[model samples]
Target: MIKYFVMGLRGFFLLAAKIWSFVCYCFKRQARTVIQHQTVRYEVIQLSPLSKHRLSMLKRKTLVLDLDETLIHSHHDGVLKPTVKPGTPPDFVLKVNIDRHPVRFFVHKRPHVDYFLEIVSQWYDLVVFTASMEIYGAAVADKLDNNKGILRRRYYRQHCHLAEGSYTKDLCDICSDLSSIFILDNSPVAYRNYQDNAIPIRSWFSDPTDTALLCLLPMLDALRFCNDVRSVLSRNLHLHRT
Candidate 1:
């Protein structure tokens, strides 16, 4: 009995060490990213009105975004609704007919997504590509865009390539110019074929404090000026570098 107990204790300590190491790594990485974002804040503030116009006039690159967990979380009766402890709340609720049944969905927007969109739209021509079916994805996009025209065009599930039970997005469908286009997605498999042009973000679900979108502004702002987005994205030193 004592031998078994000692063995179990050793295993427990090993597991605890692994967990602690992972936590420390995540904390340190976040600290570094926060410092970088602070530096970018000053640079963003210094830009003049004229500078913005000039930047907008430059050859705008295409920024393809993902929906669902990337920008918003959709919760239906069957889906998991966030406990919604403090600040986060569903932006809107929608009733849609899916396969002859009307379903109500509660959508919670990722924090800072609005400001992030406003800033990135000026720099890059925005496009939304989602793995979800058109019936649902199109409605969500419309609700999020609110007819602002910031989100230029959208591609739905029909456009995705189904491979081995996973839906993979084809970036070429959105833009022929590989150098000028890149995709912002939370799922690695979506961009598995085009890894070089992919910027991975953490999948968000009801976290009111989530700042993945805000933290991305600096790098995205700088990307517009680069000749080829792949050249910069290949470095892959991002907050959620997949």
Candidate 2:
């Protein structure tokens, strides 16, 4: 009887420890998120009043999207899956020339990615901004595009600004009009300087049930009609902090 009681006591302590550990982990995550939020300066650009003619003539809004974790996840070293689907092989087998040696990379597209790009293209000028080598980024973009003609421009790692051990994407470098340009990326650091014009997304990996891309369609569609994209983004910026 005493041994059984002791075992129960031990089990309770083990469960308690686990619960405490989980709480600490959650607190740490929240703390990190808070820090990221505080880092954002919320510097909304003061735009010159647009003339009626210029507003009417403004083309489509510009959407700069990140690669890798945002649209797809890739690894240079991995056991090639027999097929992503029953009869389909991996999406694309790309060879990148690195240091005079060829390195192969396997890419997997995010769920609903094709539909996302197709629909978004109609509403915005799509640009791929990735902190990865051009060789790799171009191949992945090609595979995803497949002549669909959605992507208007591609910016690679060379275009990114490296600071404090992380790459920061400067929207100003791409275009001077902050009101019409926005970025979608998984990394908060990438858009730290442009928080007012950033839409932070969760990193996508191998989740077949992931609906992030599809879920964004409604919001993206609405943003296309906004006079200034940053005005719409700034209101929900808190929800995206790391």
Candidate 3:
């Protein structure tokens, strides 16, 4: 009887030790998270424009962008459609003989795209990600080369899987790091996958004129702010190697 009682006591002690160890581990993890969250939050608040004369600097080194329907409008029909409000240019169609079949075409460029991209290029490293086949994406890249600069790389549809009109989780898995990375796209569905690090722009198909710059400006400003804060933190923390 005494032996059985001693074994029961040992078992209880072992179980209690495990529970204590788990609780300590959990508390330590939570404390670390709280510290990180507070640090970031405090830095952000302190860097408010009104509170400081200089903007926070960031170490952002990469900028990824979407090609089709984002940088420029390209439809499967191969027509240049224009985006205009009512009382603007009415829709028209043109016929082209392809394999002896007459095909209609309609499309146009977004306004201000040239100016917006020109300014944005000066600020960040740009890469294009597109779900379109490489052949088609390359053609669009060639056309935008003048304004957006040479696309460093193009990610095609093959890089991601399609399911029910949406790409699988592989897209986000590919761009896991949010540090200094931004994706600009018009498709809300596609952008949803990377909303945490991506900027979603509205489709400007009907009015091909460049109006997106106005909306994009605020986000750029916010990015600049984040950059400034990151710079200060890095310096104070001695994060620079050189």
Candidate 4:
């Protein structure tokens, strides 16, 4: 009788395990279908439009912007295209000492970056955080600044923590209030440790027609009024992909 009871209990457990696996498999299938549909149809879509009623002014939040791919893309050997206007600064070269050898890299600033920086500086503290080496990042930042003094701070690769062989930008290192701080990065991996506080952007390579920065103005404007940035970001963050 005891053996029969034990066998009955084992069968029940096996059935439960099978049921659980089937449920998980179905959920995964549905999630994949949803993600694939979003990728193709809504890749450049905007977040839910912010209501005018929610635009209550609050304490200024911290906006951390990534350098490479987010604001600019640089390469060691890419040829610089001729500037549309003679005085316009399209691309510049930075010489840095790496491994005791001087290396020169070409940097191309994203279109409308200057205007974006000027506008955002009024709403939040602007921080340029890059995974690139400080030697190169600082020079590029300096050129962008051009004594306008818009960028509030700068952080480099040494500031990032390595997690599972990928560089993660831990927001806790900089801000005590994670709710009020938001990071805009082109690489999702950089913000995997803090997805809710991140707004992943598409990586830019030298596309003259790119208008991503301009499109973000409305979202950024809405975010300035929120008491906690995560509340707004959580709704919008999932829409973007690296």
All candidates: TM-score: 0.74, 0.72, 0.54, 0.70
Instruction: Report the C-alpha displacement of residue 82, candidate 1, in angstroms.
Output: 5.5
Cα misplacement distance, residue 66 of candidate 4 (Å): 0.4
Q: In model 4, where is the ten-residue run with the lowest total lDDT?
A: 38-47
Task: Give the C-alpha lDDT of model 3.
Answer: 0.56
Let me know the TM-score candidate 1 reaches against the reference structure.
Answer: 0.74
Candidate 3: 10-residue stretch with minimal lDDT = 37-46
Model 1 residue 233 CA deviation in Å: 0.6
Question: Under the 3 Å rule for N, CA and C atoms, how many clashes does model 2 have?
Answer: 0
- Candidate 1's C-alpha runs over 4 A off are 1-58, 80-88, 237-242
**Against the unseen true structure, what C-alpha lDDT does each candidate score?**
0.82, 0.81, 0.56, 0.78
Cα lDDT for residue 221, candidate 3: 48
The TM-score, computed over Cα atoms with residue i paired to residue i, of candidate 3 is 0.54
lDDT of 3 at 7: 100
Per-residue lDDT of 1-242 in model 4, one digit per residue for the tens? 99999999999999999999999999998886565334111132333545433543355688999998889877763346632333444478788888898787767888778777877887788888888889888898898888988774898999999888988888888898988898999888888877889887888977666778878887887677777887878876556552
| Tens-digit lDDT string for candidate 1 (38-133) | 522314565779777767666778999999889988778565545454344579988889899999888888877777877788677899999998
